[model samples]
Target: MNIYLTRHGQTEWNTQGRLQGWQNSPLTEKGRKDAKLLGERLSKIPLDIIYSSSSQRALDTAKIIKGNRNIETIIDDNLREINMGPWEGRILEEIEKENPVEYFNYWNAPHLYVPLKGGEYFEDVQKRSVAVIDKIIKEGKYKNVLVVTHGITLKNILNYYDNKAMENLWDTPFIQGTSLSKIEVRDEGIHVPFFGDTSHLE
Candidate 1:
């Protein structure tokens, strides 16, 4: 199976440097354009199905990518961004000023970070996101699958495929908005050809 993963296009919150979490903002004009460009790149690729986060940004991106394709698109709640709870829709700079240590841990030391009231742990996010991918793999019907999700959620998913420790979760190759990652699973084993690719946008 060939799994194509992409983060939702840039949104208003994205440009504002605010945390989106479960909260949402409409996609910026650039976001829509990027999605359209990606659709053009994938036009010739035969996609069996598309799984997208319930978030509007992700769903919109999935629909844009789907374009005129007849493939079925399914919304999966498990694909949603990590529940940021109180931090949702908050500016990152403000969060850092108020909760310096925790904010630092969130980015520099993920494993040591703890969620605020109603927020989610990185471990929980990974479990839920991986569960969805496993369910898709078990279905065994799709040869080419497209998954549109949030930044943190996609990071967790890619971390699982890379088998990296939680401490190294924020490694290099940042997951840019609408960047594409490809993974191939075969009877022999799993292989990641490339990740965080944005050539389509260029």
Candidate 2:
């Protein structure tokens, strides 16, 4: 099994520094361009399934990659960005300025600070993400699968791949728009790697 996961393109809220948790925000022009470039980059790869978050941002990006292919895309709510709840559209700096204690931790130890007023816990997100990923790997049903998802979800998922404790989920780096990360199941075992290569967006 070989899995490829990508972050959705940018949106107005993303460029404007707004917390868009589960918000149905559309992608910006630049975001669309990035997705287009990503599509061109991935067109050559043989894909078994295309999966996306239920959110518009992710589906929109996934569509771009589908292009003329008849690939089917499944929308999964579990793949959505962290739910910000009360602070869905609020500015992070404002939240931090007001909550100095949270701000310090967010800066010094992001693994400790919560993203927004009512965001999902990092540990919980990591646990769920890991379970989902492990199940997919174990199934070995698809030779190749493409997933378009959100930032926080990717971070938590990567935490599992990187062998980082769930307690430091936020320590995983946030991948930018159209960035690609992959995992492979060799006959010997499984291998999760952080391959810093994004020639598709060139």
Candidate of highest lDDT: 1
Worst 10 residues of 2 by lDDT: 189-198
Local accuracy by lDDT, each model:
0.91, 0.77
Summarize candidate 1's per-residue lDDT along 1-202 as a digit string, tens digits: 9999999999999999999999999999999999998889888789999999999999999999899889899999999999988898999999999989889999999999998999999999999999999988888889999999988888888888878888988985789888999878899877678888999887
User: Judged by TM-score, which candidate is best?
Assistant: 1
Please state the error at residue 121 of candidate 1 in Å. 0.5
**Per-candidate clash tally:** 0, 0
Q: What is the lDDT of residue 193 in candidate 2?
A: 69
lDDT of 2 at 115: 58
Q: What does candidate 2 score on TM?
A: 0.89
lDDT value, residue 26 of candidate 2:
83
Candidate 2 residue-wise lDDT, 1-202, digit = tens:
7888889998998887888877867899988998898888778888988878889999999998889998988778888887766667878788677777765764466567675546676665666666766877788788888878888788777766766765565555657888888877788876666532467766
TM-score of each candidate structure, all chains considered together: 0.98, 0.89
